[model samples]
Target: MGNKQFSQAQKLTILKHAKQIGPKEAAKVAGVHYTTVYEWKRQLKELGEEAFLEHQPRRSGRGEKEITPEQESAILQVWNDNPAFGPGQVRSQLRRQGTTISIRTIRKVMEANGYTAKQKQNQVSAPERFEASRPLELAQMDILEVTINKVRVYLILLIDDFSRFILGFRLLEQTSVDEVIQLVRRAVDQYGKMEELLTDRGFVFYSWRGINRFEKYLENQGIDHTHARPHHPQTLGKVEALNKRIKNELFGQEHFSTLEQAFSALTKWVEHYNHKRPHQGLGGFLVPAERFHGQEQKALDDIANSRDVTAQIQDIERSIVNLVLAPDGSVTLYLLGQPVVIKGGSHV
Candidate 1:
C-alpha cells in the first residue's frame, strides 16, 4: 500500500501501536510504509507530541538552511557592535537577548558577512588555577603602563579573585603609593572591604626594607596583604590576563589623542566588560556584575530553570549611583533617584 495520510491523533496512535507491536507490523496494518513509521517514531522521540502535528516542512536552501534571515541579521549586528567577539561569544550574546542561535549558525552568518575568525593557537597545559571561595575573599591589584599620544600613563586595576569582578580602576599620570591607597580605599568604600589583597612586590605596593604605606593602609583597614613571589607573573595570572585583554581589546582597537579621551574610553570599556562581557571562567555565561552583587547562584538557577538571565542585565542600569542590599537577599540600585530592585534572578 502507498504511504497513507494520517491526522495528528492517528499518527500518535500509530506510534503507540508501533511500540506495542513491531513497526513493520504496525505500518502494514495502518496501510503505511515501515520507513514512514520509523521516521514518525524518530520525530516523536525528537520533538514529542509536536512531531505529530501537520506543519510545512522547512525548505532546504543555500542561506535559509538553519536559521532565518532575521537571525543572520542579528548575528551580523552583534558582530558589528563587538568586532572582538568570537562565534561562541556571539552565540552567548544572542542567547542573552532571548534568541538562541547555535555557534555553527553564528559562524556561518559571520563568514557570509565577510568576517573570518582567526585560527586559535594551540594551548599548552598550565599550572592549576585557583580562585577564592566567595566574593570579597581576596582581591588582586595590578598596574599596567601604556603610552598614549607619546605620553606614558598608568592604569591601576583591582579585581576580586572569586568573581573576577573589577572592584575599581583608575587611569593616572603616575603610579604612587598614595594613588594605590586611594583606589583601594574607593573600592573598599564601594564594595564592602575584602578580607585580603594580593599584589606583586612593586615598590609602590611593597618595600624591600619594610612595609610600604600601601601595606600600612591595608593593615589599618584590617585586610591582609600578600605579595606574589618575586619574578613570578603566573602568581598574579588573573590580573595579568586582564591587562592583556585591555591591551588587545581596548588600546589595540581605538586610538586616543589625549589622556582624557583614553580615560573616557577606558571607563566605558570597563563598564561593558563588567556588565555585558561573559566570562569564560564563569561558565561562559555569567557576567562579573552578577557575581559582584551576590547574584551568581540565582543566575545559575535561572539558567537551570531555562529562564533568561538577561533580565538581570537589562534591569540593572549602568554606572550605578548606589547599591543597597536588602535583608531578604534582594539588591536595590539607585540611579538618579530611581530605585530598581532585583531579586531571585529577576528584576522587580
Candidate 2:
C-alpha cells in the first residue's frame, strides 16, 4: 500500500525488467522499493493477464452508505448553528450528539452546500495557542473603534476566555480610564469576578508609570491584570473576533444620536450574545451561558445590573456642574447610567 501506484504498463515493464536483471537491482534502477517489485511479481504470478489490467471488482456490500440523508441533515444543522465551524468542529459536534462522522464527510456535506470557500481559509499562520479552562479562570478585555452612520464609537468589551461569553461591553463616544474601570467593575459585579484579565497595553488598561485606574481597580478586586504582547491580538482571540462581528452587526446596522442610546442598545445586544448566540468554540450547540454554567443560563435581570452598577460619577458636587434636565424631568447625571431627577430636584 505504501508503494507509488504504477500504471498497468508500468507494472508490466517493472516485472520484465526484474526478470532480465534481479528484483532488488531492478527496484534500485527504477527508484522504487524492493517490496514494490516483489509485490508486482506476486500479483503477476497469481493473476497473470489480469495483474497488469486497471479494473478491479467492486467492494462487498458497503453497509448503508456512511453518509446518509439523516447524517447530512445533522451536518447541516451544525452548519446552521455555527457557520464558522470547520469539519473538525462539525465532527466534534456529531460525536457529542451521539454520532461519529469523519472530517472528510463533514467537508463534503459543507462543500456540497457551497460553504467550503468560506470555511476553508488558508491556515498558514500559527494557530491560537492560548486557552482558558473555565468561565472566570481568565477573561479578555479590549477596545475597538467603529463608525456608526459617520459617528465614531469606541467599544470596551470583556469576554470570558473559556466560554466565549461577552462578560461586558459598552459602546461609547470616547475611551477613558473611568469608562474602562467601570467596564471591569460591571464584569466583576455581575460574573462574580474573574481570576485573571487579559488585555492589550492600551493607556486605559495599562500604565508605564507604576499603576493606573484600571490596574488599581484590579488590585482592589483581587483580579490579576495581564497585558497581551504589543502586537498580539491572537492572545485575546475571543474578544478580538467578537469586536469585529459586533462592529458589522450592531454598529454597522444602526445610527445612534447619543452615546447613551448606543450603550442601551449594546446592553441588549450583549445580553443576546451571552444568552442566545451559540458559539462554535463551545461545540456550536451551547451558548456562552450554557458553556459557562452547565444547564443554567443567566437571565437578563441578573446581568442587566451593569446599568444599575454605574455609568459615571454620581455625587452632585462631582457630576452636576453642567446639570440640565429634559422637559419630562429626565436627566443623565452620571457616567454610570441615566439617573433621572424630578423638577423638584428629587431622584426619579
Candidate 3:
C-alpha cells in the first residue's frame, strides 16, 4: 500500500479498532502496516493525541523551512567567522552563544547559502582510541612536512594526549634531532614534565641501531619514550588529525611567501584551536584549554546549570593588589593604596 497521511481523528479511530481487534487485524482492515499501527499506539501512549497534531507529513523540495531570518543571519555569520566549521560545529557555536538551533536547520541554511559541499564518508572501522587519565600524563609528538613558497619545511608538534592540547609547536627548516629535543624541552618547561612521551618510529625519535639524542634526553628527564607500531599512522591518531586540520584550515586557505608569515599564521590558528574553537572530541562544547587547566568539571557544571561560561574579565584598567572581605560581608579592593568598595549583596 502507498504511504498515507492520517488525521488525528482517523488515527484515534484506528487505535480504537486496534484495541478491539489486535494491531495486525486492525492494520489489515485499515490497509496500513502492522508496525505503523504499533508506532501510532506508542506515540499516543507516550505523548497523547496532541503529538499527532504536531507531526508534519513529509513533502517534496526541502519541505517547509522553519528557521527565522535572524537565525539564518546568525548561521551565516558563524560560517563567515570560521569557514572550516561544518553544520555540527555551527550548532555547537550557536549553542555556546545562547542560541539553541538544530543541526538540520543549520545544514539547511548552509546548503541554501552554497557553503556546504558533498563529503565522502569514511567506511573503514576506526581503531580503538585511548587517552591518558589526566593532563601531563602522556604527550604525543609528531612532525608534518609541508612546502611553503617552494621551500621544504617541517612542522613539529607536541600535544597533550589527555586534553589534545598543543603544548608546543615549531616550524623548522629541517627535522633535526636537536630541534625535536628543544621542542620537548620547551613543552616540559612550560607545562611540567610528562610521565610518558609517544611518537612514531622516526629517525629523530627512535634509533634503529642505537639510542638517538632525543631518546637520551627523554631518559634524562625521567620520561618513558614510547614508539608507535611501524607503518601504523593510526597509533598517533590525535596528532595526525591535528596535522590534517592544520593543512586544511590554515595552509589550504592562505598562501604564504615566507616561513615567518606561515609561522605567525600557525600560532594564531593554534591559539584559536585551543581557546576558541569547540573540539568535537571534548563533547563539542569544552575547549582544550579548559581541560588542560583542570576547569573541565566547572565548565561542564556551568553549562549544565544554563549559566554563561564564557563570561570573563578580559581587561582591567587598574592592577589589583589585594581583595579584602569585611566582617559584614562586603568586599574591598586595595589598588595602589587606593580602596574601592564592591557591594557583596546580589543584584537583581
Candidate 4:
C-alpha cells in the first residue's frame, strides 16, 4: 500500500528500455529491481503515463449491472426526503415500494448519485473508551441541551451501555444535584439496580456533596461508581448518540413553549423510541428494546404479570398517603410531609 516516488522521465526511460531489452539487464542498467522494471514496462505499454500517477484498475471479478437514470433519481428523492433512512432501510423500503433492487445496488446508486450517508460528527477529536460486557452491567448518564420558551432546559438521560437502550429520561429546569439523584433513584427503583454507574465529571456529578452521597449509597448497595475523564465527553458515546437521535426525532425543527410541553412530548417520543424505532447500530435495523430485552414468546398470563408490575408505577400520588406494607402484611402510616426512609417496600 506504500508508494515509491519516481521522476516522470526516469519512469518513461525505464519503461522504454525494459520493453526493448530483458528485465534483468534493463534493471541492472537502470539500477532498480527487475520486478519493478517489468511492472513499469507493462504499465506503460498498457496504460501509458497515467498509470504512473494514478492507481491501476482493481480486479472486481464481475462488473455491476447498469441502473437507469430514473432509478437513480428515485433513490435520490427517497434519500433526500428521509434524511435518517440509510441504504439498507431505503433498499428494503424500495423493494416494498415495488423496486426489484438489492441493497448493494442501492448503495452503488447512492454513491453515484451523490447521496452520501449523514454522519453524526462530534466537534471533539479524541477517542474515549467505556465497555460494559453484560446487559444492565453499567449505565452512562448525561445531560443534553434543549430550548423551551427561549430558556434552555437540560435533558437528563440514562442509557444502558451494553443494550444501547435509553433507560430513562427527564426534562429538568436545571442540572441540579437533587434532580439527577432523584432521577437516578427512580431509574434504579424501576429497572432493578445497575452494577455500576458511569458519568462525566460535570458540576452535578463531581460535586463533593452529591458525589459523597452517591458513593456512600452505591457502596452500601455494593455497586461500583466511576467518573469519566474531565473534558473528554466522548467517554460516554452511547449516551451522547442517544441524546442526538432523541433531540432530532422528538424536538427537531420545532420550538417548545414550555418545559411541561417539552417533557410531555419527550415522554411520548421516548416510548416510541424504545418500542418502535429501528436502530442502525443493532444489525438488520432491529428495535433496541427488542434486542435488549429478548423478543421471547410471552403467554397471556405473562402479559398479565407485566401489566401488574406496570400498574405499580401508575398509582395516583394524589390519592395516596405515606403508608408502608409490613412483612407480615400489615399497613402503617407515617406522618405526612415527614422525610422517613421506607425500606424495600412500596409507599402509597
Order of candidate numbers by TM-score, starting with the best = 3, 1, 4, 2
Judge candidate 1 against the unseen true structure and give its global Cα lDDT, from 0 to 1. 0.78
The C-alpha stretches of model 2 lying farther than 4 A from their native spots are 1-116, 119-121, 252-265, 296-348
lDDT of 4 at 161: 80
State the lDDT of candidate 3 residue by residue for 4-80, as single tens digits. 66776787899999889988799778776555676667668777777765665566334234446588789889888
Encode model 2's per-residue lDDT on 205-229: one tens digit a residue: 8899899987998898878888988
For TM-score, the strongest prediction is 3
lDDT, candidate 1, at 69? 55
Candidate lDDT values, in order: 0.78, 0.67, 0.78, 0.62
What's model 4's lDDT at 298?
26
Measured over all alpha carbons after superposition, the RMSD of each candidate to the real structure, in angstroms, is 14.1, 17.9, 14.1, 15.7
Instruction: Show the colliding residue pairs in model 3.
Output: none
Across 124-204, the per-residue lDDT of candidate 1 in tens digits comes to 778578897666778999999998988889999999998898999989888899989999899877777787899998889
- The Cα RMSD in angstroms, rounded to one decimal, for candidate 3 relative to the true structure is 14.1
Tens-place lDDT digits, model 4, residues 1-348: 122345656777766776678666876676654445555555666676766546433443332244555676677766775556678866533443445456766776565344556778777656755566444668899989887777877999987786676778878777777777788788767665677889887777766554566566667876677888777767888888888877776678567788887888788777655654445565433445653453312211333343222222223121122344667896655332122347776443
User: How much is 27 displaced in model 2, in angstroms?
Assistant: 54
Higher-lDDT candidate of 3 and 4 = 3
Q: How close is every model to the real structure, measured as TM-score?
A: 0.70, 0.53, 0.71, 0.55
